[model samples]
Target chain A: MARIYNFSAGPSMLPEPVLQQAQQEMLDWRGSGMSVMEMSHRGPHFMAIAEQMKNDLIELLAVPANYRVLFLQAGASAQFAMIPQNILNGKTKACYVNTGAWSTAAIKEAGKYCEVQVAASGESTAFTTIPAYADWRVDPAAAYLHYTSNETIHGVEFNDIPDAGDLPLVCDMSSNILSRRVDIGHYGLIYAGAQKNMGPSGVTVVIVRDDLVGLEAKNTPAVFSYAQQAKADSMLNTPATYNWYLLGLTLQWLKGEGGVVAIEQRNIRKANKLYQAIDDSSLYRNPVDPACRSRMNVPFVLADATLDKAFLEQAEQQGLSTLAGHRSVGGMRASIYNAMPEAGVEALIEFMAEFERTH
Target chain B: MARIYNFSAGPSMLPEPVLQQAQQEMLDWRGSGMSVMEMSHRGPHFMAIAEQMKNDLIELLAVPANYRVLFLQAGASAQFAMIPQNILNGKTKACYVNTGAWSTAAIKEAGKYCEVQVAASGESTAFTTIPAYADWRVDPAAAYLHYTSNETIHGVEFNDIPDAGDLPLVCDMSSNILSRRVDIGHYGLIYAGAQKNMGPSGVTVVIVRDDLVGLEAKNTPAVFSYAQQAKADSMLNTPATYNWYLLGLTLQWLKGEGGVVAIEQRNIRKANKLYQAIDDSSLYRNPVDPACRSRMNVPFVLADATLDKAFLEQAEQQGLSTLAGHRSVGGMRASIYNAMPEAGVEALIEFMAEFERTH
Candidate 1:
């Protein structure tokens, strides 16, 4: 069978070119006589690969000189604990915005280390809309303010970076990091699991401003300390060598596709088409607010829940795989990240239309 | 260049058959129309992969029904902290045996969460020999006994398990797991990083006894909490999905080559041949105690210190790669894990003889 458009929320579709390049280099990487997985993390060959990957990511994101880009493990979930551990800096409280599942999770974890102040919440609106920034009650004395840039499950995203006053702004960009342009200078920290927009699972990218590098709480694991990891260039321990190489390949592929800016344009066009199709149809309706619906994960529900099984079965047959929405919000979700070609989205749209016409 | 014998301490060589299978399935996994990297970790396809991999490991290790095997991230370094955090069980002190570099590192991390009691030390012997078992000062009140079964950097290993009496025994088997048979019933927890004997760098295998599952310290990260992760089947977060698949493939290959009991015999032969060659050569020597020398990583030095660079260069030219010893130790090290074939070791021995004859 030909490669299908995988709509998995994470560990999702990667660029076909990246996969091809990986397969080509599986036995021996670039004449080095060893797979990337076999190279010593500290050896010359792997060091070169690691350096190029970090530099490419910094270049693609236009990250500020004052910030350090770290490739880590344990995903964005680890950062939920690490953010407060490293950046809380002796403060007794942290402010968090509860936009959806991801934010709520972060807030819960932060509560373990410090007093959590829920600055604002979208739960009142069933997580379908981002709470108005003007209405948020952020505590200025808090150590930092954290929020999830894109709520992957609820399909809500913030259109603009929210100001956190004097407190450092932290963002979890797991579902939408490279899909759009953002000034890295706006946040004190930004982290995303590579499984989504980057490459595969295992590696997490953390971009932190220089000032947030130190100040870990006592008893913090060395591997999770941003200060220690950044000092070692994220090689404080044996890293995920093969995953790093795959991530580098993906970034190189992105550059060939004209970097983040160009890719963002494509993402916006693709997202608009899918959302337009959803809005244009009566049978399918997206519950998320029009202004804040996630461009990476577009979730919708059919008017009649009875057709859900048939809709998914037919979509799978059409090679539009994993269209089911999150179990918490049962319907259908089409996660079209940067690697998800526009043709894949079009294919999903056509299938949805045909299904609606028949049912 | 052809695939050479990689002898890096970690992130070492993998079976060619595993790499070949991965390459063959890179674009589409068994007609799933998606790469394994593209599958949802929760979807049926990935769930099947995950199950098979876990079951294979359990079968290969003969893991007792009372043990839970977890596929985790952040490598074994994270386990250093997690072990104490999860199993301290309100005890203030834990006993640790210091054999070499890995044990020293584990002790350092474990100290952050509990009062570390040195049960025995090989440091007095320059980490070349394990201390006498009868001389160990085991504290009955301690929460657990921690020891590194094999040290990659120091080329040392424990010939037999140390009796901790009634205390839960924890072993860091990262560099030598699956190369030998062991009774899982004897351990409270056994953790190994996948880069060496298992598969890749992103995944760490943790086999923990049921009695040691809960009892996490306050504020422990959910992802690192053994009890919570066990309940979630190690899906507490998005795992390193592709890494797990690779590990599964490696395990399957191992099963085909004969399980741990069979691999142990081969490993013994490989290590013995390499050691015999070094002992026979007047130009080369290994400093480790013969009784407890590692079967995985064998660190040796040339009689003439000046020949180090030439030895590495000429070895590389002969397609023998990454033979350089760890930087901390400064010599030559050959890590012949389970995946390393007898032919590769024979090639190395032949090269060693030729190099000795010339220089």
Candidate 2:
């Protein structure tokens, strides 16, 4: 098989090893004579797989015992609605730090269930940098302070996790989850859609504080109820089983590759190489402040904007895919997620250098 | 790969051809060197697949242009909340015919958003039959009347579609979708989770009337808004691309096998054979009414209840799996879906007769 590098934002790239393992197990998973898709979610075989995934994740993230992990359908967008519905607790207000497109969406969804205050915002900077904590005004009695840890679209990140004082902190880490080490004890909730850095598009991993479990409003459907889903071990309704299985494969890969600490070093190296190239080059520049710039999504623009199309086309011919910036804010973005090998970054850097020399 | 029969009710059996095609295309989908799951939902490749799925479904169902198709996530269960959110249109009430588990769930979720009237119910018979249309007491002013066309758990089906008498009709055809022909014009909405007879669990197909597009409640999330999804051509968010691809393959298979008309006759034959054998046997009994018995799932109980355990264990050892009925109502269930060849059903019947004779 030919080596291919995919740079999609989500449903993006998976580890080649995971894909190979999946293909091998596609028809008969571990001698079960059934594809993981065909296994009964309730059967012992599937239950074991689900348990192993949850266990591996707990180990990978060092998830505290007081937190509940839920493998749910619908992506991080669903959690936008689910978070408030579960944690509103009759509180009329919630604090949100707007960092990028995803946090903006989270704030919008939170607004429906509670009064959301923009405690801090990176919007004024075109989402190129995280707002300083000194500028934030968090309410003492607010239910929780919501934030997006990594913004896939704008390529902005909070290098330092926010301090919410005593208020619970909810983070949407969809784009950069498991790429680095974090103190799981610090935040009240951490949710990441699996598409970008984890496994696939269908499942969202939600880790919530145990005390926050059963606070769903009267109208909450059983399917969306945190308490209900948690009690059911995220098998509340037949989960995206195949996706769960793939996640298990990815988690195993992460473990075999020396876990989060080892992976983070690789991620840092990859991001630093690309960012250094952009910072040192005259033809391209990344606008975000170096301190808060994302290590996952690197959004940069060409000095001569007219050359953008030609650059993208040339990049595509060389097999560099999905380097186009989000249409919401156009330029170019190269998402160097955990699944993206160091060699891919080296190749991208080589290509950029060659393109600049020619153009 | 070893051949096996999967008897799961939802996330159920897929066509062998579909699975084979998927396996063959796992590493390189159409020479693109990207699995369908790895493709960007927005890209040309995925857009083509999405459009083709819609076109094929329209062709299969003969759906009129006036009805818009939205491929959504979160399963049929999500539609439970979505229906009242979109269709209520300020109407105070919605009429729901309680057939079995799925309909009951829809009514429960709908109750949160609108006044839900039990227009008719099969609960009196433990959901063993579809409620007769003559017995219905629909609210003329209700926004829409909902029913489950086929109850997977109860093994009951509506042999005839109901007339809503000017009110819009909504059917949860999760278990019976694409098994037979239907007049799509009569429905305001037809939603089915694509796990049962369709493809996978993540993608839910909702065929809604064009007029029913723009009435989401002010609080409805953009992702769940039918009107919003329709405008985006079901690329509202990164959808279950692999699942959608599989659905297109199933639709292609249906078309190749002479479409729904041909499948329906075969289903009828399969159902008749299995039901007839149960009726003839002194040792077995299926409680559903003759007019309402499902062609998809046939739940039967042994007359000698003591042998039920032995029968299931022996059946499993022989590679006949998931014969145990739903926990809600337990005995034995043989789900003869479109993918279940007649030979499998015949083999099951032969095993049943042998077990009965030996006992």
Per-model tally of clashing residue pairs: 0, 0
**Tens-digit lDDT track of model 2 for B1-359:** 36666666766677878777878888778867788888888888888988898899999999998989988877788889888888899888999999888888888889999899999998998998776688899989999999999988889999888999999999998889899889989899999888777776678899999989999887776778899889988876777777788889989988988899999999999999999999999999999999889999999999888898999889877778888899999899998888888888888889989998999
Give the per-residue Cα lDDT of candidate 1 at A159: 88
i-RMSD of all predictions: 0.7, 1.9
lDDT tens string, model 1, B111-210? 8998999999999899999999989999999999999999999999887888989999999999988999888899999999999998989999999999
Native-referenced TM-scores of chain A, all candidate models: 0.99, 0.98
- Model 2 chain A: worst 10 consecutive residues (lDDT sum): A1-10
lDDT, candidate 2, at B148? 93
What is the clash tally of candidate 2? 0
Error of 2 at A229 (Å): 1.3
TM-score of each: 0.99, 0.98
Candidate 1 backbone collisions, by pair: none
Candidate 1 wrongly placed segments (more than 4 Å): none
Please give me the DockQ of candidate 1 compared with the native complex. 0.89
Taken over the whole model, the C-alpha lDDT of each candidate is 0.94, 0.87
Per-residue accuracy of model 1 over A1-359 as CA lDDT, tens digit each: 99998999999999999999999999999999999998899999999999999999999999999999999999899999999989989999999999999999999999899999999999999999988888999999999999999998999998899998888999999999989999999999999999998999999999999999988998999999998999899998999999999999999999999999899999999999999999999999999989898999999999999999999999999899999999988899999999999999999989889998999
